[model samples]
Target: MPHFRIETNVPKSKIPQDFVSKAIPVLAKALGKPEQYCVVSLIAEVPMNFGGSTDPCAIGNLMSIGALGVEQNKKHAKVLFELVERELGVPQDRMYITFQDEPTGNVGFKGTTFHSLFG
Candidate 1:
């Protein structure tokens, strides 16, 4: 399963439906998984100020799906940033993306683990 947690200074009500629709397919294609496997959670951060020494103009996490190498992750980040900018009006310069892969047996579902569901 691919889980996405998106945090933004933008209002939750302002988020575009098209953005969510397009994101699932695009992310699924990039991850080589079915769209049905994608799980997304959008969190709105009001009164948030983004900017720092390490990551200036940082808005929020772009991609929090699975672990990939730096180069590959950056590539995905670029896609995510562009989408957010175009769809949500968030600037590319004001975002950061991170990915972490859950261990094989870590994530679970209703009454069983993700692996159990598939296996």
Candidate 2:
């Protein structure tokens, strides 16, 4: 599972209508995952601040099972920054993206942890 979430101070009305739809493919390719297994969520028009200012900024988190590393994260961050800039006009410098590598034992699906399925 590669779950990506966006929390931004930008107004939803200012965002492109097809932004979310366009993001699916970008996210999948960024993570080297199939689109069907990826999840993208947006929490827009929310209060956010960075460097003690309420400028147009975003804090994003991507949680996933494997497929995360320094180089991969750098690449993902680049695409994410472009996306945020396109949708919210938030500069890359004003945005932050965090990648969390969740182990299978810690991620559960159905009635059991993903670790159990492979074991």
Candidate 3:
């Protein structure tokens, strides 16, 4: 499972209608995961201050069972940042993204943990 969640100061109306749609494929391709298992969410119009400015900025979190590390995350950051900037007008310099490698045992799906299913 891979989840990409972004919270931005950009207003909802300013967010493109195809933002999530565009992000899904990008995230899936970057993580080498199936599009069906990828989740992308955007919370727009958030009250956020970055570097003491209320300008267009975002905080992103990416959680996945695998496919996350220094090199991989660097690639993901590049692709995802481009998508955000193109769709939400949030510059890459104004955003920060954090990555997390989730434990399969801690994530459940279809009434059972992924560890139980995969292990």
Candidate 4:
């Protein structure tokens, strides 16, 4: 089975349960894998300024979600953007998301080893 990893840049204080509930299923569906087979890891970063004019409030609320090597990372990127926009009330342009592919062995799941270890 293909492995998947999700690295999110949200506030450390933010509840992981919130992200996990939404993210796990999205990754599983996007990667065409069973939800139970997927692994998710999150890395929270302190909020940072985006520079230039936009919305200070929005900039302060910036977050990034990175999904590593699913079947359709790019497509999932779009989905993630939309999801953040709707969930967090941040504009699509204000949020950032990305996906990358790694060597098969570089990622793992569960006790068997996959992209990440969520459970």
Best candidate per lDDT, number? 3
> Where is model 3 poorest over a 10-residue stretch in terms of lDDT?
13-22
Give lDDT per model, in order: 0.66, 0.87, 0.93, 0.49
Write down the TM-score for model 1.
0.77
Q: State residue 13's C-alpha deviation in candidate 4, in Å.
A: 8.4
Model 4 TM-score is 0.55
- The TM-score of candidate 3 is 0.97
Give lDDT for model 1: 0.66
Assess every candidate by TM-score: 0.77, 0.90, 0.97, 0.55
User: What lDDT tens digits, residue by residue, belong to model 1 across residues 13-36?
Assistant: 778856667788877776767888
Give me the displacement of residue 24 in model 1, in angstroms: 0.6
Clashing pairs in 1: 67-101
- Score residue 10 of candidate 1 by CA lDDT: 78
Candidate rank order under TM-score:
3, 2, 1, 4
- Model 4 has an lDDT value of 0.49
For candidate 2, write residues 1-119 as lDDT tens digits: 78889999989888888877788898999888899878888889888888999989898899989889999888888888898898779988888888999999998887998799864
Give me the displacement of residue 80 in model 1, in angstroms: 0.8
Best by TM-score: 3
How much is the lDDT of residue 15 in candidate 2? 83
